[model samples]
Target: MRKVMFAMNISIDGCHEHTHFNPGEDLMDYFTGLMQDTGVIVYGRKTYELMVPFWPEVAKNRTGRPCDVAFADAMTRIEKIVLSRTLENADETTRIVRGDPEGLIRELKQQPGEKIAFSSTSLLPRLLEAGLIDELYLIVHPVLVGENKRLFDNFLVPEKLNYRLEYTRLFKSGAMALHYQKSE
Candidate 1:
């Protein structure tokens, strides 16, 4: 079975607003590496809309820094699954899935593939509650955005979910990449 990995960038204060922090070259490279290793990426409607046109355009035009371009290229190569009830269509590489995201992910895990990555903050709570995430990568940035949606804003698990830290890397930008595996 493929491992389900949940990755996101968060502020020291737990804010998950993407625009709040600018990822440096090292951080961008880190993300690129993650994308390279992932076979499939799952996003919510909001994240898919924010990423698709922008990343695909970047990949096509080869704009921005080298790291950015590489990250965009990697993003464009991966298969994407968007879980949204209202989204009617997506690009060729993406599939718009409606209803029962948990079930869909569960089914995906049973199939042979590389790691499945989750990139949507809105769906994090649901995924955690369902105990579907096998690994987690939290890129904790140094700065704090005082007022933004937090990483666990709506997470209300009945019991604690445990994870063991498997790896940690600190970038020059002061952001730290923390990799954790779900504890047995």
Candidate 2:
């Protein structure tokens, strides 16, 4: 079974606005590795709209930094599954999925693949509550944005979610990549 990994770039205070945080080369490289390892990426409607146009442009023009370009290229190569009730169609590389999110995700996990990655935090709470996420890669940045969207905006877990810290990597920018697995 493929692991469901929830990966996100969040602030020290738990803010998760992509525009607010600037991913340095090393951070971008880390994301590139995740993209390369992931067979399919799951995105919510909002994130899909935000990334669909930008990453393809970066992939085509190679206009971004070396790390950005590499990340973009990797992103373009992977399969994308956007779960949205409003979105009807997407690019050839992506599939638009509607209906029960947890049930569909369970089916995806049973499939043979490298990994199924949850790239959108908006979709995390539901999957986390359903106990579908196997691991988490939280890239905690140094700065704190006082007011913004949080990583767990509407999270409501009945029981306390236990996690074991798999490892940690401190970046030069003072940001840290924290890896955790859901404790059984």
Candidate 3:
């Protein structure tokens, strides 16, 4: 069976609340590695917009230090499907798909290839409610905020995860990489 990896950058208190996209280098390297292994990448609408513009152009003419270069490079080849009601078009490599979101995911799980889903907090909750996720890779960050998106806040159902500690790493910037496998 293919694994659906829910990799994200969250707070130290298990809160994914963030003001803006500031995923660190360690986290980027880690996910980029996983994304390299994955043949397909599924992302939420917000995530798509945040990530799409920086790709394949080496941070889109931004001077100085490169941000997520591996991620930009890897994203060019990996097939991406962005789930959005508002997004009308995608670039040459990607396809903008509109439909009942979960219904589409349910169908993808039955097909072939190693698939991975990025920070679709909205969709992840639904998948958990449906008991469909096979694996999850979450990266815990250091900061916390007053108003931002929390991964499980909008989740409708409670899930008891039988997970295994796959890997753990501490970054110099006071971040932690917490990898969990849904054992059940």
Residue-wise C-alpha lDDT for candidate 1, range 1-184, written one tens digit per residue? 9889998899999998889888889999999999987989999999999999899999999999999999999999999999999998899999988989899899999989899998788888999999999999999999978998899989999899999999999999899999999998
Give RMSD (Å) of candidate 2 vs. truth.
Answer: 1.0
For each of the candidates, give the backbone clash count.
0, 0, 0
The 10 consecutive residues of candidate 2 with the worst lDDT sum are 117-126
RMSD, one per candidate, in order: 0.9, 1.0, 2.5
What TM-score fits each model?
Answer: 0.97, 0.96, 0.84
Candidate 3 TM-score, C-alpha based? 0.84
Model 1: residues >4 Å from true position, as ranges?
A: none
Among these predicted structures, which one has the highest lDDT?
1
Cand. 1 TM to true fold: 0.97
Prediction 2 TM-score vs. true: 0.96
Model 2 agreement with the true structure over 17-100: per-residue lDDT tens digits: 888788889999998988877999888989999899799899999988999899999999988999999997898899988888
Ranking by TM-score: 1, 2, 3
Q: How well does model 1 score by local distance difference test?
A: 0.92
Model 3: worst 10 consecutive residues (lDDT sum): 58-67
Clashing pairs in 2: none
